[model samples]
Target: MNAPTHSHPRVLVTWESKHGSTAEISYAIAGVLREHGVRVTLSRADEADIDDADDGFVIGSAVYAGHWMKHAKHFVQEYSKKLLAKPVWLFSSGPVGNPPKPDEPAVDVAEMIECTAAVEHHIFGGNLTPSR
Candidate 1:
């Protein structure tokens, strides 16, 4: 179970979904942030308007080949300055399975970059199911 979210202003959640599971998680995250009084918006990583959104960000992507989707990576680069200056939370949706893996670990995409937002990154179990 996930813990409660931190409240903030102008929270933006950007996601990349090949089959929409990543999107679902991103929306849930935005919902929780809104519940906590954060003004949030969920959009495709490529579609986010990063202009003066200097408050906060909640960026996420679906992992593919041990990496974040290309669009999400680009989004981070595009908003690198604003992100670093603001509070940010990064997450990924991947490594779907039932547990018991000694070698495999979760990967957080935003952590790989030089984030501008004093960001905390997390990765959640993601679905490979086509129907999800």
Candidate 2:
């Protein structure tokens, strides 16, 4: 049989943000993926639809007290079996300061990777405003 044909890879970019910083990062990622011709579905983790038709996933969350937001954690736990069958990437956004304090990864990152079999994880500097 001829090799199966497929459309552009579809990626799900989902995030949980309490102050909107993490969500912005997710949007940027989705934009970059789109620029590269990948089809992206951007949504909040709690509201994201886990579709098997997606070829990969990029999940992110705001880190609070060294842990990922609950909605993000629940999303990964809820769809981990499906995630493991595809390419998965994880990100945590939190560390606000001139030098970006906390200089360490989120506490639950290891567990999340284990659950999702994610290929990579990234930690991005966060944005915090006094008014927030």
Candidate 3:
């Protein structure tokens, strides 16, 4: 892990996960960012404090019916201005099966990305546990 070049490089990692899968992704992301010497705060979308983080953001959510969770969407709406002024990255966790179908389209965060002018976006495979 490389030490962050910037002083106090804080990153806020927020997400919305109905089944804990997306939260796992958020934690993993936070861990990686911390390993790189970034100060990280991991929280649910509704719980994150926009003012608490000034450097960057990594926001993610689980996709359902081809859309992001409502709380995640609301978080972006509420913090759009602040997010736009900083470096932001977006991620989506879906495509549950081991071998994702080729026809599965990527999670759509284009509107949010446009609003924040996000530096990057990623879509990751998710895990689904069937209820017994």
Reference-based lDDT, each prediction = 0.73, 0.92, 0.83
lDDT by residue (tens digit), candidate 2, 86-130 = 999999999777789646889999999999999999999888887
Best by lDDT: 2
Q: Quantify how close model 3 is to the true structure by its C-alpha RMSD in Å.
A: 4.8
The per-residue C-alpha lDDT of model 2 at residue 113 equals: 98
- lDDT comparing candidate 3 with the true structure: 0.83
TM-score of each: 0.79, 0.93, 0.86
Model 1: how far is 53 from its true place, Å?
4.2
Give the alpha carbon lDDT tens digit for every residue of 31-70 in model 3.
8888989999888998877864459899998887778898
lDDT of residue 90 for candidate 3: 89
* Between candidates 1 and 3, the TM-score winner: 3
True-structure lDDT of candidate 1: 0.73
Ranking by TM-score: 2, 3, 1
